[model samples]
Target: MIIKRKVNKEVYMYSIGIDIGTTNCKLCVFELLSLKLIDSYSFATPKINSKYGYDFDIEALYSQLEQGLIQTINSLSYAEKVKNIVIASVGESGVLINQEGEVVGPCITWYDTRTQKNLADINQKFSDEELYSITGIPIHSNYSLTKILWIRENCNINLQQVKWLCIAEYIAYKLTNQKRAECSLASRTLAYDLKNHCWSEKIQSAFAINHLFADFTQSGKNIEVLTSTISTKLNCNQPIFVAIGGHDHMCGSIAAELKPGEILNSTGTTEGLLLLLEKVNFNKSFLTSQLSFGKYVKDDLYTLYASLPSAGYSIEWFKRTFSVTDENFDLLIESLLNKLDDINYIKNSLNIFIPHLRGSGPPKRNIDSKGLWYGLGENSTLADILLSIFQGLCFELKNTLITIEQLTVTHHPIIKVIGAAAKNPLWLQLKADILGREILSCNIKEAVCKGGVMLAGYENHYLDKNAHIQFDNPIARYIPNPKMTEYYHQIFADYYQPFFEFKTSLEFKLKKDN
Candidate 1:
C-alpha cells in the first residue's frame, strides 16, 4: 500500500492510532507535521458470553470499531489525509479456535481470574522463579496461558486446528485477514522466551499444551495492508497501512521517548511504571526474563516494567462503595484539598490503605490478597480514607521503583507521568514525594495513541531527520518536597514491611492448602 506524500502548507499528513483497551477502545488521528493530535474518539467494549464458561463478543467489537472510526473520521478536519492506521491492543495467550479459524472463545481478558487452580498447578510444576525467568511475567491466573490450560481441562474442545493469537493479532486478523502477532505482544505470553524472541520449546514442553502459537513480528514493522472492504468502509481512496506496534506499555514508552534513568508511568484503569535500560539485569531470586521488545530508537534500549492491577479502578471502587456521585466525588476530593491545605495528608496521615480490592500485582502477584485499612480509628473520616487511597497507590509505585532500583543500580531518574491519572495534581505530587524524585508530566494525555502516531509518522516520513515529534505542549516538572519525602519514607518502610511479611505468609499458606 503506497501513499503519495504531497507536501502542502496548510494540509498536513495524518496518522491514526487505535488502542483496544480492556473497558473501552480509543481512536486518535495526529498531524504528521507537528505530531499534534488532530481528532480522537472512543467507544465502550461490547461484552460477550460463551457456552464454554468464557464470554466474548466479536460482533460487538466489529461494531464498535466501525462506529469509532466513522465518528472519528467525521469529526476530523481533514479525514482524507489519514494515511496510516496502527493498533496497540491488550495482551492474552488464548487461541481463537474453529474449523474455519474463527474466534470461538471470548477474548480472555487479562483481568479474568478463573484460572487460579491452573496457575497454582503450573507454579507447583515449574517453580515460580523458573517460570518468571522464562516468561518475564510472574505466574498469574490472569495470563492467557493459564486461561487456555483451564479451558482445556474443563471444556470438551479439541486443541488441534486452533490458532493462538493475542488481542492485537485477533483484531488485525479481523481487519486485514492476517494471523500475525508482534514481538511486543508475544513476549507477554508465558510461552514466549524473551531471550530468543520466540515461543519457548522448554516452557511449552513443561506445560504440555498443544502448539497453536502465531508467527511473531518485530515492533515498528508493517505487517499487512488494510483490506479493500475496510478501506471502503472508511471512505478512503488511499490504502490503510497496518504496522506492528507492540504492547500498549512499550508503545507508550516509545511515544514518551523513554531513556535510561527515565521512567514512563501510564495511569489508566491499571497504572504501570516502565524503566528503560541499556542491558538486562537478571535476578535469580525473582526469575525474571531478560527478553525485551526491540526499540524503535536508533540505540539499543530495554524496559523494566511494574504494573498495578488496580489504580484508577481503586478510585472507581471507592466511589461505588461510598455511593459518591461523579460530581460529588470531584467536589469531595477538591474539598479535601481545601480542608487539608496546610497538612501533607497523603504522607503524614496516620491511616494506611492496602489497595488490593481486586488483587495484588507485580513483585507479589497474590490473587488472594484483599484490600486492608491500617492505622484507622475513630478519628478516621471520609477525607482520611480518600487520602489513604492515594497514599496506597503511591506506596505501590514506590515499591515498584525500589525493586527496579535494586535490580538496576540507578537512582533519581526523572519519571514521566502520563494518562488520566497524571492529570491529578495531588496524585502526581504524592507520587513525587513517595519516590523522592522529580516527576515529568507530558502535555499529551493520550501518550499511547501518540506513540502509535509517532511510529506511523516515521514510517510515512513525516518526522524530521532527527525523528522528533514537534509539539506545542511543554513538559511539566514537579519536584519532591523534602519534608513530605522524609515522612513518606518512614511510612512506606513501616507499612510495606508488614505487607510483604503478610504476603509471604499468605503465599506459604496457599501452597500448603493446595
Candidate 2:
C-alpha cells in the first residue's frame, strides 16, 4: 500500500473526474501534483418513469455530462493542458446500448423496486450461500442481474442488437468508444466472478445475458485515447486518456487512503460502510447478514459493503415533513444541540427512528420494511426527533460494523467519516458516542472525485505506486464521551439488540411465506 512518488519528466498534470451520482453529476478538475481542486461543475441527473419503475435517461445523462465537462474545462487557463478524464459512478444502474453505441433502454436505477417480483425466482435458482460464494453478493433485486431479468421478462428488448454497459462504461464509451466494463462497477452486476475477475457464467446463464456484458478492464487502466470528435466537441487539444474509475464508494475509499481493518462510512443520499479485504471470508455472518463483496480499484483487493438505503434520505424526509428549509436547517439543528445540556434526559426521552423510508438493507433486505418512530409521545420536541434520526442511523451502522467484525474476526478502532454528513459536528459526535469509536472527519468533500483523479495519475505514470498512500490530515477527530458511550452500550444490548432481533425474525418469516 506504499505509494512511491514517480519521478516523471512531467512537472504539472491535470485530470478531470466526472462523478456520475444518483442525485447529481459533478465534474471536478484536480492538479495532480498537490491533489488540489482546480475547478468543478455540477448538474442534476434526470429521472424518468417507465411502466415498471424509475429509470435514468442515459442520453440525458450524457448530454448533461458533456455540458458540465465542457464548461469546467473551458474555465481552465490552459484548457488543452488536461491529460486524463476518469469517471466514477453509482453501481448497479446499467443500460443496454445498440451496436451504434446508442442506448437502447433507460438506465434502470438501483433504487427502483420493479425487480421485487424476481427475487423469489433468484433465490430459488441459487441459494444465498451459493450465490455469495460465486459472486460475493447475496440474492437481492437491487443488483443488475435481477434488473436485467425483470427487463427481459417485461420489456421486449432486442437482445441481439445491444451490449450491456454500466454508467461508468457508458460514459467512457461516449468519450472514447471503449466499452470495457470497469471491474469495481462490473462486480455489482451479481454476475461477476470475484475470484476470477470475470463475468460469472452461472449467473449470466440464469438471466440469459451471456453475451451482453462488456469485456472486463482493470480500474484506472487507460482504455482508450480520447476520440478526436470528443476533443473537438470539448474544445480541448491535449491528448486525453479516458479511464474507468470504478464504483463511487470504492473510489471514495481510495481518496480516504483506507487501510485494512479500517472502515469508510460514506454518508450521502444513502449511507454505506466499506471495508477492504485481501481475502474473502465466506463466514455465515457475512452470508446471512447480506454483506456484499465487490472488486476494489486494486486488482488483487476486494471490498465488503453494507448500507442503509434511507440513512440520509430519512433526514431529508424529516426536513421536508417538518418544513425545515435549507436556509434554516443548520440553525434548527444548532438550536436543538443547545437544548441538550442533560445527556441523561436527552437519551431517556429521545425516540428511536428506524430509517427505512425506502426499505431496509442487509440482514433482512426487506423492501416491505417501513420507516418507524418508536418511543415518541406528546412531550417529544423537534430536537428529540432530529437527534433520534441521527441516533437511528448510527445504530444501523453500528450493527453493520458488528456484523463485519464478527465475520472477519477483526476490530477497526477508528472510522473514516466522509461526504456530506461528515460536516455536521453533531452527527459526527453522535456516531462516536453510539459506536464508541474515534471518528475522523475528512476535510475533502469530494473524496470520490479525488479518487478518480488519483487513479488517473497512477495510470498515467505520474504517481509513484510504491509510496505510502497519504491522506491530508483529518480536519477533526471526535472522541466518544465515556459516559455516553457506556450508556449507549447498555441501550444497544438491552433495547436495540432485542428490537432488531424481533424485527429481523418477523421479516425472515414474511420472506419465507412470500
Please write out the lDDT profile of model 1 over residues 224-319, one tens digit for every residue.
777888878777776666765667877777677776677688877888877766655446644442222222222446556667878988998888
- Give me the overall lDDT of model 2: 0.82
Cα lDDT of model 1 overall?
0.70
Give stretches of model 2 more than 4 Å off.
1-10, 339-341, 466-474, 508-514
How many collisions between residues are there in candidate 2?
9
* lDDT for residue 230 in candidate 1, whole number 0-100: 82
Q: For each candidate in turn, give its C-alpha RMSD to the true structure in angstroms.
A: 3.9, 4.1
Task: Single out the weakest 10-residue window by summed lDDT for candidate 1.
Answer: 289-298
TM-score: model 1 vs. ground truth: 0.89
Predicted candidate 2 versus true structure: per-residue lDDT over 452-487, tens digit per residue: 888777777867765555455556898988888888
Give residue 438's lDDT in candidate 2 (0 to 100).
95
